[model samples]
Target: MTSPSFNPYHEWLGIDPSISAPDHYQLIGVPRDEQNPETISRAADAAMSRVRQVRPGDKSQEWARVLDELREAKSCLTNQGR
Candidate 1:
């Protein structure tokens, strides 16, 4: 399905009929308030933790990517502190 909000393509969840004007939007997905960033970050942390638990042999680009995400998240919070 395409994004009902704007995109020429639908998003994973499906269309939301509540959004009347689809073309004006950039993309369609769950709203931030409904799917908060903190909630998403927690899910990401859990997945990364599981990977470390099962495979402690070494880290890979995937782990690095997760770390980068963590760094970015940290920056956001720290910047807010300023």
Candidate 2:
């Protein structure tokens, strides 16, 4: 079963009445950390990647993130030049 932490989308749709959706998400219990920051970072990256992989998307939807990041970088560089 998916953990309660992953229920925002369903809850937002007014589906889970027995459990009141929190005004904000509460990440209780454990802190996410690793001896190597890259390890935890990679795990989060892979999990999000798997979610996207499971839901195949249109090209723009798929590439939107990388494109947006590049655009932001270009803007930052242009501002630095001025």
Candidate that scores best on lDDT: 1
Which runs in model 2 stand beyond 4 Å of their true positions?
1-33, 56-82
Tens digits of per-residue lDDT, candidate 1, 1-82, equal 3223532122211335454333211122223333445654554454445434533123344345444544454344334435
Q: Weakest 10 consecutive residues, lDDT, candidate 1? A: 21-30
Overall lDDT per candidate, in order of appearance: 0.37, 0.34
Per-candidate TM-scores read 0.30, 0.28
C-alpha RMSD for every candidate? 11.3, 11.5
**Native-structure RMSD, model 1:** 11.3
Clashing residue pairs in candidate 2 are: none
- Write down the lDDT that model 2 would get: 0.34
